[model samples]
Structures are given as C-alpha cells and as structure tokens.
Target: MTMTRKDIGLATRRAVLGDAHVARAQEATTAFDAPFQDLIAEGAWGRVWTSEAISRRERSMLTIALLAALGHDEELAMHCRATVRTGASAEDVREALMHVAIYAGVPAANRALKIAKAVFAEMAADTDQTDSEKGGDHDKG
Candidate 1:
C-alpha cells in the first residue's frame, strides 16, 4: 500500500529527530496546534526531508544554517540534536553557524552557536549515560 504524506512524514521525522523527541511533540500537541503540526509533518518532513536530492547530513547542515539565519533558536537547537542521527558533525555545525554569522549577522550566529553548544553537551551527556548503562569501555579495562 502506498504511504500517505503524514505516514511518510512521520517516518522521516522520527528517523531524523528520534522517537523520543517526536513522541513528546506529538503528546504535547494541543487541539489548536495539532493541525499546524500535521502541516509541518506533511510539508516539511514528507516533502522536503524525504527528498532524495540531498543527503540527510547535507540537509541537517542546511537546516541548521537556515534556522540560525532566521533566528529560530528552538528549532536550531532541536536540529542540532538531530545532527547525531543525521551524520552532521559538530565541526559541520560550527561551519554552518559561521556561515550564518557572515550572511545573517554576528548576533544571530552567536546565539545559534550557543544553542548548538548546549545541544551538543546534552547529546554527549546522554551518550555517556547510555554507555555507562551498557557497561561500555570500563568493562573492557
């Protein structure tokens, strides 16, 4: 059976943003914002993210830069976290933010970088916790 736009979008969104993040967004959706969420899932995640023309890593980088330039701090931070799944490196994020600084403004890029750094720290902490839980590395020594 052919998947609907929402289906495609949901899959793409979960893959990029991780299930926990997507689930939280879904659970928090109010009746007023539900339609808006569906629109972004279908339009942005389905149409844009599912596009094969660009790799997910490239898309992540582009998205981070665009969000930074637009001063969309929350989305920028969310996307920065998603970079772990998208294969965009921290260095890649830095380069994108630098581009944002040049084209957008120093203030915008500065704020975006700060958000990115926080997200990166959170991601690293999560990994460390998971690794510890899994008896990673320390068990080998």
Candidate 2:
C-alpha cells in the first residue's frame, strides 16, 4: 500500500515529536486554525523534516538554532523537548545555541538556553516519574 504525503507527514511528525505532543496539538486544534495546522503538517513535516538528506539530529539542532535566533520561544521549547525523539543531545543543542549566540546575538542564545534548560528539566522529571511508575530502580534503596 502506498502512503500519501499527508500520511507520510503525519507518521514523520509523530515519530519526531512523539504521540503525546501530537495528541495535545490535535486536541488544541479548532476549525479556525485547521488550515494552518495542515500547512505545518504537510509543509514542515512532510517537505522539510521528511527529507533524508540530513539526519533528524542535525535537523533538530538546526531547528532549535533557527527558532532561538528568531525568538520563537514557545516553539523553541517544543523543539527542545522533541530533541529526545530527534536524538539531539543537550550538548548538541548547546553547541547549536552557541552558534546562535554568535550569529543571532547573545541575548537570543541566552534566552533560548534558559528555555532549553527548563524544558530539559521537565523532560527529565517526566522520565523519572515514568521510570518510578514502572518500578525502575525500586531496589536501589
């Protein structure tokens, strides 16, 4: 069976952003912004992200840097969290933001770093809670 672009895009989107995030976005979507959402899904995820020319890790870093440089803080935080699925490590993100500091100014990098730190911390806490729920490290006492 051949998957259409929309299908491929949605699959790629879920793969990179995770199901929970996508679900939240879907839930938040209304008729008002439906077209905008479709554009992002088909354009950004399908056209840009689905390209194999660059690895998702590289893409993640690039996206983070671009978002930071553009002062898209909310989106930046979302991308920072997406790094978990994108395989872009914290160090990789930091390096990307360092480039932003030079090219996009220190203030942008500084703000992005702060947002990334908070997002990473939240991700870590979520992971810890999931692990504890699964009884991971329960014997460490």
Candidate 3:
C-alpha cells in the first residue's frame, strides 16, 4: 500500500522528535486545532523535514538558528532537546547561535544559549540516571 503524505509526515516527525513527543501532541490535539496539526504534519514534517537536500543534523542546527532568531523560545528549547536525536552536538548549537548573535541579535542568541544549556543539562542528568540504573558508567550524547 502506498503511504499518504500524512503517513510520511507522521513517520518523519516521529523519527525526528521521537514517539513520546508525537504521542503527547496527538493526545493534546483537539477538533479546533486538528487542521493546524495536519498542516504542519504535511508541510513542515513532510515537505521540509523529509526532504533529502540536507542531513537531519544540519537541519537541526538551521532550525535552531531560525527559532532563536525569531524569538520562538518554546520551540527553540524543544529543538535543543531534540539535538540528541538529530545528532546535533552542543557545539553545533553553540556555533549556530553564534551566527544568530551576529546576523540576528545578541539578545536572541543569549536567550537561546540559556535554553540550550538547560536542556543539555537535563539530558545529561537523564543519561546519568539511566546509566546508574543499569549499573554502568555509560556515556550518552
């Protein structure tokens, strides 16, 4: 069977953001916002994110910079959390935000840095906890 655009987009969204995040959004979806959700699924996730023009890591960095420059704090922080899945290292984010500072503004980059730092710290703590639970000092990105 051929997959529809929504199917392709939902899969791409899950791959980029993970199942849990997608589940949360799905669970929170209502009749009023259903169309909006579908729009993003078909547009952002399907058309843009699913494109092969660039790697996910590069896309992650670019998204981060745009989110930061646009002052989309909530989305900016969420993308920072998604870096582990996107393979965008903290250093990559730092460099991206540097561009934001130069081309966008200092304040935007500063706020993005704080958000990224907090998210990374939380991710590290989660990793440390998981490692301790497994009785090994496994390092995670």
Model 3 CA deviation exceeding 4 Å by range: 136-141
Kindly list the per-residue Cα lDDT of model 2 for residues 94-124, writing each as its tens digit.
Answer: 9999999999999999999999999999999
Clashing pairs in 1: none
How does candidate 2 fare on TM-score?
0.90
Please give, for residues 61-111, the per-residue lDDT of candidate 1 as tens digits.
999999999989889998998988999999999999999999989999999
Q: Model 2 Cα displacement at 63 (Å)?
A: 0.2
Whichever of 2 and 3 has more TM-score, that candidate is 3
Clashing pairs in 3: none
Q: In candidate 3, how many Å is residue 83 off?
A: 1.1
What TM-scores do the predictions have? 0.90, 0.90, 0.94
Query: How high is the lDDT of residue 134 in model 1?
Result: 83
Model 3 over residues 1-141: C-alpha lDDT tens digits?
A: 998888899999998888999999999999999999999999999889999999999999999999999999999988998888899999999999999999999999999999999999999999999879777534442
Candidate 3: give its CA RMSD in angstroms: 3.6
lDDT of each: 0.94, 0.93, 0.94
Ranking of predictions according to lDDT: 1, 3, 2
Whole-model alpha-carbon lDDT for candidate 2:
0.93
